[model samples]
Every structure is written in C-alpha cells, then in structure tokens.
Target: MDVWKLNLRHLRSVAMTVRLGNLKAVAKKINLSQPAVTQSIIKIEEWFGAQFFVRHPSGMHPTEFANVLSPRIEMALNLIGSNRVTSTQARAFLSLSKTGSYVAASRDIGISQPSLHRNVADLQSVLNFKLVEPRGRGIALTPKGISVARKFLLARLQLEAGFSEIYALLGKETGHISIGAMPLSRASLLPSVLVAFQKRHPHITISVVEGGHGELIEPVRDGHLDIIIGAIREHPIGKDLIQIPLFTDQPVVIGRKDHPLTKVFEKNACCQNSQIMKLAHYPWYMPGKGAPINVVWRELFNRVPVDIPNIPIMGGSVMMIRQLLLETDGLTLLSPDQVAVELEADWLVQICTVPEWMQRDIGITYRTNWHPTRAQSYLLELLNHHSRK
Candidate 1:
C-alpha cells in the first residue's frame, strides 16, 4: 500500500485522539479547530481505506482499528521527533551508545557494528522512517530521531531502576547461589556449612553439585560457577587462577572388622608382602588413578619391593565401598570422613598398623581471582569459620 505516503502528523493526530478520547480535546491540544481535526481523521481513514472513529452525540471516539493503530503511531511520532539528532546524541539519549568509533556497539553487544546497524535499519523500515543521516562528517538524527531518543531515554530509565533493585536484593541475600564440590569434601564439610548458611539467611536459595577433580574445576575458571571445593595438587595451578587450602584429610587403610590382619600388625610395621597378597585376592576397592589417594598408594606400593601391578578393586561410591568393606574380606582405600558412620558403629575397623606410607592429604580448592557475590562471600566466611572449629 506504499505506507510511506502516511505522514507523522496524521499518525500523531490519530494517537492524540485515541489518547484524549474526544475531538474537542485533541483539537485544543493540537491548536486546530474541531472541523480541521475531524478532517485529518477522515483523510487518514480514506488513505487507508478504513474507518478510524465512531461518532456519537457526546463526543468522537476512536474505533477498534484506531485503537490498534495507537502504539504504532506513538512510535512513529517518536521517530519523527528524534529525526534531527546525531547518532552520537541519540546514543547519549539511549544510554547504550559506545565511545570511540560508532562501530563499538558490536563489541558491547558481542556482534559486529554492521550487524547492529542492520538491525537498526530493519526497525526503521518497519516504522517507515529514517532514524539517522550523515552531516558533513558525522551522522545526525532528524526530528523523528529526536523523538525516538526521548522515548528510548524513558525506557532506559525504567530498565536501570529495575536492575538496581535486583542488584540490591542480591546484596541482601535474596538471590540464589549454586556451588560445585569435589567428592572428598561433599558429605561432611558441605553439610555443616549449608546448615549454618540457611539458618542465617533463609531467603537465599542454595544448590550443590558433587563431582570429581577433573569433572568440576573448569566451570569455576569459565565463570559458570561462583566457587568450587576441589583438591589441588602442589604443582599444577593454572594461569589466571588461584587456590586456597580449606582443610586437610588424612588417608587411612581399612578392612573388614574380623580380618586376620586386624590382629597381626605392629604399630608401624610395613604392610607385610604375604599379608598384602592375602588381602589382594579379595575384591580390592581403590580411588581412580591420579587422585591424591591413588597417587599415595602408587608411591607406597612401589617402595614395597614387590612387582605387583598395583591394581585395586574399583567401587565408585563411598557408601558402596564401605558396604564391601563390612560384608567381605576386602581392602578399601578411603578418607576418614567416608567411613565415619561405619567407624561409629564398629562395622569397619582401621588397620592402623600399616607402614606410615599410606597417609595422604586432602584439601578444598577454589579459583583465586574470583570476585565472589555477596552470598558467595558469606558462604566462604561460614566455611572458614566452621573449618577452624
């Protein structure tokens, strides 16, 4: 229908009449007589081959079609009014304009400037308006451009106010925090910390994910996780990352409570070669290779003066490993915390007579350069406080 033939004046008249609800008021506001205002509506209706108003004795009211046109007309008026502004000046009004070259919007939005400019062009086509123009050296907005900038400023103000409230609420512990944890630290350490945090800030939401060393730490480095509780080896700290030692774990050797080794070992005797062979026949449970506990076992086994392959039975869950230790004549390598329940019940007995070689260290690791949110910082403080006691 060649909609470009439609003028902003006609669109504004329609919108004002819809907004004001009667011809006399719209006429007074636009400094036009009542008949002139009525003619403008008639002209627009004829141009579009549609009815825009339904006349009555009390006043003139916009028809259903006129109601539909109001928002588009409002937008048209904005574009027409802001048509005289420079692109820089319009950006200042929109509050999203970048400094330096105009192309920087692509960087801010993570796209190229040409792409954003294309999007702006698409919007102008739909609105049937021109938003910006080049002066001698730089771009300027037409009167319609000024109008667009004013409407954009109003919207930006409302948006900024909403984000400010969200930021403030996050500071107040009203938002959610998700944490990832390594297996060794999950059960005993995290439960205590979570209980304390929930008591103090019941409004904050909390979630925890449990995984192994290789499975968990990358999310922290990529900014997907706020904090992580994983073990760090002494030598492998990566670039642009930091680590903090939380609490250390001492590894222990365990076996079925009634096994013969329970009665045979002296306080510090090396695990006997014959006795190791006897236990090796039973299902052996070991942590994954390269794990700190596994590394300790590798070192200790090499020094034993034996040529065994050093392979142990593999059970993934601590609970399952503990069950095997209780019901069968098997050996399981574990941290003390993994067997707390069994130790309390005497279902599993510590075979402490092994050479001092079996003891290993465990600790919590996290990114060093992370700038934690308020909830995250609060949780870390809770962890620190509890670890001390």
Candidate 2:
C-alpha cells in the first residue's frame, strides 16, 4: 500500500491513544468528542483491514499488530522533532545548545511505557486529536499508523540531508569550534572570519561567548573555548594557559577636532599640567575597570580624575567611542591599529603617540596546552598569515 496517503497527525493520534489507557481520557486530552475519537479508530481499522485493538468494559487494549508497530511510531516522532541525528534541531535535542531532560523526551515521544501514558495524554489534549484505542498495559499501531510513521522518517532524513549540505559548504560538516571575544570584535571581525571559514569548509559548527579577558581565559584553559581574541593582559591562571600573538597595538592619544590638545602637539609632553588639566576637563572617555588600558592609564597618571564620573565614558565599544569623538570633545586613548581607518579618513587626528613611558601589545590568545579544532586552527592560521601581510 502507498504510505504517502498516511499523515503524521494520524500516526500521532494512534501513538497517543495507545499510551493513554482509555478512549474517554484520550477524548478529554485531545479535546474531541468521544464519538470523533471512535470514528478515527473505525477509519484506521478500515484502512488497515486489521483488528488492532480489543475493546473491553474496563478500556480498550492492543492486539498483536499494535506491539509490532510501536517502534515505527517512535522513529516517526523523532524524525519530526529533528532528533534523527542530522537535523539542526538535533543540536537542541541532544542538550548541546542547552539541556534536554530524559523525562521530557520520554513523555513527548512515547518511547517508554510509563512516560508514554503521560505524554500521550498531554499531546492528545494539545493536538485536539485521537488515533489509538488503548488495551490494558499494551499498545498497538493501526496498519495506517505504521505506514505513516515510516514515510515521515524517510522524508525527514531527506530534508535533514539538504540542510546538512548547506552548512557543510561553510565548513560545519566535520568539526566544532568555540570562540571567546569581546562584543565589538565578536560583532565585527569574528563574523567576517566565520563567513570566510564557512565558505572554505561548510560543515563545521561554531559557538561563541563574550566577556572580559580575564573572565574569558578560564574557559580556554578548561578546553571549552578554543581560542580568544583580545588585547593581552595577565596570563590566564594555571600552568596550562597557552597564547599565540595575533597582532600588537600602538597606543595613540585621540581627541575631538576642536579640542585644544588636538592642535597643540609638544612631542614628549606630559599630560599632568594646568593646560593638560584644562584639556582633561573636556570629558575624557576611558576603558572599563580592570581593563589593561584603564589599569595602565591609572598607574601612569597615578590618580583617577573625580571630574568624569560617568561609567558610560569608559566602554569597550570602539565605534561608539569614535562617534563620541566625532560629535563631542571627549578624549580617549586607543590602539592605533583599531583606529587606522578613522585616522586615514581624517575623522580623528592623533593628539599624541605614546611617549617612551607607555605602550602595550594586542594579540589573539589561546590556552597553551589546548589543541584547536580544524576550523579553529584554520582561522588562527589565516589571521596569523594576514597579520604578516
């Protein structure tokens, strides 16, 4: 018989009824009249040309055919849920994206005896439908139910393969990679790199987490995060921390175009004078607490200005800081590399390069003992290769 005529709804109904012990309960669960549930049972029996359920005063019960069809019902439900091993939904199903409870899956899928009862009861109510007549402790699939589930599984596999191929084109086909970065780098550079990586090796799956340098490093040490991109600070705690330099930053002093400091340049001038204090009066933008740049600035200046108390003035968003520089005379210190395009565009003019007293390095970092995934290794190789260029 052509199973194409059978539908998942019918299979689901049959699977649910078999698990719930009574048609009355199934009727209540599926929000259908008991008569409607009875009609489904009749139509299924007619299509299958088999007596699948044995009715009794206590409740309906499954026959020999029902026992044979149970496994097929399970496969069908799994296919729909993308739990068939290849669907993107499989990521959520396997508890990789998050956690999936055994009780929840058992109840929903009707693959286990106890869970099947509750799941069917719950599912029938939500779907407002019914399919199987329960018989004692056993359940059976109507012939149509078996046929429908098999068809669904086949179709699901084909659909999953199609999506798999698309992701494969982007390097997600063979491995997994986890990355750690700040929000700006995460939003800009990393996405571009991911797009490039995907084009080269389509089957790899990518994951990301964003946080501070010290906060992000621990994940790298435990083998959770594969690589991190940030300005170097303290080495990650423990002997296992490994790091590879991506690039270094050249420090620069930046101010709004109208700021007096922008026009006045005395090479090797210290920033701690009455004129400089007047310059600092123009709302200085700073990096956040504990950031390497902030720490260095505090140590060199030896005192935090009580004048600019707003924390938004100290943020990591390079673009926002640049925009503030364009619209206001907020002073900010930045890495020359990150500001190159702006400097070239004349949107910003460097007020000062670092005096010999201050400079810092920026680089891509990873744990020492950790090994990178193929995709991760590929990206690092590309970044390193391009840094030299």
Candidate 3:
C-alpha cells in the first residue's frame, strides 16, 4: 500500500498499542475510544495484507513484520509530523525527550509545567498515542515514544538544512551536507571533490561519515545523509535508492613498497609469468562479509581455484589496512583509484592487475525520491563534475 495514504493518527495508534500492550490502555492514554484504537491497528494490518500484531488473551504481541517495520514507520510518521504537528507541540515533545522530565522540559522550553503538559496532551490527542510514561516521580518515553522522539529530533535537523540552502541560494554564507562516504569514495574521489567544493562554496558545512558499502546505504536512504558516494553494485540495489554512475574502478592487489611480490614482478618484467604467482603465499587483509569488496574478492579468487586463506583480518577500514600494508607484510585487495594518493606517495605498490570483468562502477547513491534544495543540488553538481575530472 502507498505510505502517503496512511496518516499520522493511524501510525501512532498501532505503534502505541504495540508499545503499551493493549487497546484499552492505548485508548485511555491517547484519549481515544477503545473501538477507534482497535480500528486503527486493523486498518494498518489491512494495508500490509498481514497482521502486524497477534492478538492474545492478555495483549497484542508484535509479529516479525512489526519488528522490522518499527523504524520505517516512525520515520514516515516523523516526516508527516513536520506538516501536522505545531512548532510548540513538537518542541514540547522534543524537550521532554531531551530532559526526560516534565519540570525540566518545561524549564528548557520556557513554558509552565501545566502548559507543557497541555501541549503534550494536545499532541497525543492529535497523534492518538502515548508519548510519556510514569517513571518514579517524573517521566520517561515508551518504546514507541522513544522512536518517535528520536526521529522528530533528526527530522528537525533535516528541516533546518532547508534554511541553509535558502541562505546559500540568496548568496548568504550558509549550507550543510551530511555525506556518508563508502570505502572507495573516501580515497581519491571524495577528498578531491571536498577541497574543490569548499573553494567554490566556502560557507557550506560538510560532515563526512565513513562506512562500508552496506553500512552507508541506509542513512542516505533515510534522509540522515545528504548523499553517499561509493562503488555501485552490479546487482539490483533496492528501489528506494537511485544510482548515478561516475566511473569504473578496477581492483588491484597492493602491498608495501618493498614487498617481495612487487620485487619479483619488477625483476621478471613479464605479466604472464607474474599472473601464475600463488596467492596463498602471503598473509591477507580481507573485507568483512556483505561488503562489496568481499564479493569482488571471492569472484576474482574463486575462479582461479586457490584455497582462500582464513583471513588474518576481516574489516572495511581502508585507513587501518593502508597502515598495515605499509608497515607489515599483509596484502589487501582494493580499487587502485581508491589508493591513488598512497601509491603516488610511494607508500604502497600494486602487485597484481584485476580482471577487466571485476572492475567496480563508482557512483553516487542517494534516496530515489529525495528532492534536493538549490545548495544541496549544487553540491551534487560539484560531485558530478568531480567524477568527470
């Protein structure tokens, strides 16, 4: 079912009923009739063509689908809330979450306790869910409440980016882009692009979060990151993400400058002779499972019928691998373009060439439906230009 067809009230009803354990408690907390709350949860189940919660003698137990959908639903509700919830109600909710106490929340927001309570009450009425719960003498959020609070806080940050974009458009010094940098992007492409981007748009703020191929996708998909720059996969990425090709990068085996493998290659001066070298002779640094590099590594090596060693190290941190390869005798497989800076600096040497078929497509991956503001789009344009250069 289309998510936009679902409203804030319906989501809150299901989330709260699940969190609080029963319809009667959820109805009382949200100031809704028990039947209305029951109907809300049923309507959500109908949308999915399956039940989210299993009704029992005592309470509703969340199904596996409900567990999986918890975060996504909260995110959807948060997006809807930006339009449906007032600034005061949102602030009250956010402040309560931050302080974890009614008195502290009121003080932080410059509102009386009763006013804060009323704001929260009104918000709950509109949302049809319980946000706060009795914790000792003060308050705490239910599971559903905690999820909603975190999403709303993050949504507020995403919203503020629009103001920066507006200022940047008007020629004022302002903008922010949270970038999730995958392993390949962290090396040559992103570093060069960031420098050029800063030179062109000095006022823009940029935050780079480094992660593996799989690790970087979710934040960009969820709107926590402005964009993710990395190696594009050959297989289908989810429909939610859009891939824009930048360039192709071939994998290469790298070692220390004075490594025995490089020494033999330079001495023989023959690629055909070098291609027969036994891969198991050396200690290896392997990428972790589910990383794109790991798949490429298995594909390249398995065809040759070599016993892949029990990896001495399995990880995705390029910086650590770079240092390990430089100091110790450990070797790693990576895109040559990723370590161009190191190679040029004479710290590492390429020992073997990657198969042409194994070359990875480097590109930009972002949420398919994301509509970038002028400044955000300007940053993307800069990235597109970087790929060309």
| Regions of model 2 farther than 4 Å from truth | 1-172, 183-199, 205-210, 218-224, 266-279, 303-312, 367-369
In candidate 1, clashing pairs total: 26
lDDT of 3 by residue, 1-389 (tens): 11323554676777777678888998997778999988988886776565778889999898765554554445545564644566578778888988989989989878899999998998887788898899997898988787777566555554454334434434575757899988788777788888888887787788999887777776776566867888787788899888888887777788888987775665323224235345556788877867777787776556765666457877877788898898878888887776888988989988877667767788888876565655677778877888787
Number of the top lDDT candidate: 3
- Candidate 2: C-alpha lDDT: 0.56
Give the clash count for each candidate: 26, 30, 0
Compose the digit string of candidate 1's lDDT tens values, residues 72-186: 5565345434433233333332322222233545555455666567656655665578866766544566777655654554332222222222344435325556678776777
* Tens digits of lDDT, candidate 2, 357-379: 45665467665534343445688
Q: State each model's C-alpha RMSD to the native.
A: 17.8, 17.3, 13.8
Local accuracy by lDDT, each model: 0.61, 0.56, 0.73
The best candidate by TM-score is 3
TM-score of 1: 0.53
Tell me each candidate's TM-score.
0.53, 0.50, 0.68
Model 3 weakest 10-residue run by lDDT:
267-276
